[model samples]
Target: MTAHQLLGSDRHRDLRVRAERGAALGDAVMTSLVVPAEFRRVQDEYPILFRMNQERTDFVALALFGFENGENLFLKGDRWDARYRPLALAIQPFLIGHAAPDSDVRQVHVDTASPRISGDGEGIRVFDGDGRPTPYLEEVAELLGELDAGYRESAAFFAALRQHNLLEPFTLEIELDDGSINRLVGYHAIDEQKLAALGPDALGALHGEGHLMPIFMAVASLGRIAELVARKNQRNADG
Candidate 1:
């Protein structure tokens, strides 16, 4: 179904409106959840250029979704950056994904876009000059298929978070290739003390065990409540 369709119902529209207005923490989480699906859609419909940003090598995935309106959506995530900024931009699609040399990295360019694929000392690169490429129709279609599958699996996890009302307040800290660090903070609430107790090694172990996301989601939910209470107290004092 189309995005508009997914967001067409009154309940979904209400959530969307609240999210657009920055009303609820859950809204932000839902927004993050929808972005990968949208990116998958773009990968299916248009030519996407993929390359590695070696300077910021921590990013696990990045994609630019160009629309007909001269706008683009930049979606990126890193294992270190706790914040999931989906729909992060409205620019051209310049997508990248971090893959180990042994990992499978895929790119797809549409026939209408001028597509070129090359390899550098670092990794494989794909470019679409006119934003159209006709030669790799089958390849592009397969890439989209894979992304769609990934989206579905990820969405299931996102949906669970939403159901638990634990979407915002978690943050991601990423260490890039340059040794600089970036943090992405979520709107969901969290307990700094509890998170600190977990420590980096415990957190890493949890992530390795596939429990990190859920745990982070729970922390973020609590953190959001803490923030709200603090803000309310500040407002009361001002009054």
Candidate 2:
């Protein structure tokens, strides 16, 4: 089934709720702890920051270090790689926290009943409902790993919000490379007046202090921030 079909009925309901509430949690943490840390580090390392794009799923912050090739890097939320599974799983609880308890939400379970290497002898494969080899098994494994690692942290944060009854309404959309999108999860409406009172600068400072290192490290591993920007600009111009 396609990703949308795979979402099933319950998943769709969860998506709707997340689209309305997830952003408050994401925005609060990111603006307060993630962005400022990144800004400080980038500023110290590079002479200038050319463009910084922060959306719910698409987060691209870049800096320009005037080396021979110039240096650039970006952090992204969506990836097909297995390495990100832990992160995805970590975020799942928060996504589902606002889900209706009686919703037909079912955990995905893989049957490792029989595993075999592919015909190409290059990788292992597993059979699904029909006896066909599921593609991207390796990628799935990596995602699982990321999910395992990330779940606890996400749960803790989500729990705190629930305890304080501060769960805010927000939305989250995952834009894939195939031009299709998925609404992952959400929460309740937040106190806008209080959030607004924090102001942008204060929020920025918080992000810089708390989340900069992890975000910076993730992007740097993906690509050179400077190069990515240059390539993006080139693509826009050509288009």
Candidate 3:
């Protein structure tokens, strides 16, 4: 159902993408993959959590949006009720692709099946009449570049966390105002006790590796969990 194509000016000269926020545009998600580079902004709005991939080979960070699947409490009509959206979510319909598995070259790929792909000249144009990329396309390209670099940085960060044994399994339990219980499992969080127990050598190693700030940011992000619950309660009340 995904029709990905290498974005080219000549082939997609008239291509337009709707830059709107809504479930119809694939914005209704409970979590978005985040990287350490965006942790400062993400922690301010969303709780940063960690989860292992389906293969259980690597750990990926996530910005939590809701407690349930496909439930984005931040969705208020067509607007996302947050100042910062995780890059993984913000870079919709566009993804970084490689020329080959062994190639370092990156290319922009567009999902042609996305609802954001406009056919009636109802959205932002990718290329102008001169075949040059529009401002929006340029911005998207920059975002993709950042995302690509962030992914590489994230792999190193996760490896460091594993090396230090700083991640621990976590389960979140939420009780709504209406007395309904919700549980979030299969996730991990920074082990504060273990972090505090680290000696000067380990601390220095983490700081030297440029991961200390983001680790603290991820820890600080847990405070946003309460805010997330409040949003869910408000959503229920509205309904």
Candidate 4:
């Protein structure tokens, strides 16, 4: 259902991408993949949690937006309520592509099938009349690069958490004003007790590896869980 092609000025000169937020453009979601690099900004708006991938071998960080599938509480009308969006979500419809399997070089690839692909002249242009990347494309490139680096750095970060037993299972129960209960399960969060009980040597090791700040940031982000509940309550009350 996706047609990923290497983005080229010659091939996609007139191609435009919609930058607005909406469910039709695939913005509807309960959680978004997040990287530690953006944890500071994400923590300020959304709770950061960890979930096992399909293979259940490694953990991936997520920025929680709602409690149910296809429900994004931060989505207010056509605009995202948060000031900062996770790079993973911001780099939608575009991804880093390699020229070859073994090649270190990266190229930008676009999903031609994405609803964000504009048919009319109603969105941001990828290339200018001079057949060069527009400022929007330039920004997309930067976001892609940062997301790529963050994904790579996350391997070591997750390994450190596993080695130190800093991740633990988490379950959340939310009660809306209408007294309906929502239970969220099958997620893991930073184990504050384990983190605090670590010996100085272990703590120093984590700090030296540059994994300490993000760990705390993930913990701090739990406060936003209450925010999500409030948003959910407001949505229900409005209805």
Candidates in order, TM-scores: namely: 0.25, 0.26, 0.98, 0.98
Model 3 ranges off by over 4 Å = none
When sorted by TM-score, best at the front, the candidate numbers are 3, 4, 2, 1
86-110 per-residue lDDT for model 4 (tens digits): 9988988899999999998999999
Better of 1 and 4 by lDDT: 4
lDDT of prediction 4: 0.94
What TM-score would you give candidate 4 relative to the actual structure? 0.98
Error of 4 at 166 (Å): 0.8
lDDT of 2: 0.32
**Superposition TM-score, candidate 2 onto the true structure:** 0.26
Q: Which structure among the candidates has the greatest lDDT? A: 4
Report the number of the highest-TM-score candidate.
3
lDDT of 3 by residue, 1-239 (tens): 89989999999999999998999999998999999999999999999999998898999999999999999999998999999988887778899988998999999999999999998889999999999999999999898989899998888899999999999999988899989999999999999999999999999999999999999999999999999999999989988
- State the C-alpha lDDT per candidate: 0.32, 0.32, 0.93, 0.94
Across 126-233, the per-residue lDDT of candidate 2 in tens digits comes to 333444334433345444444444443333433332343433443435333445443423322333455445657745753554442333343343243344345434
Number of backbone collisions per candidate: 31, 36, 0, 0
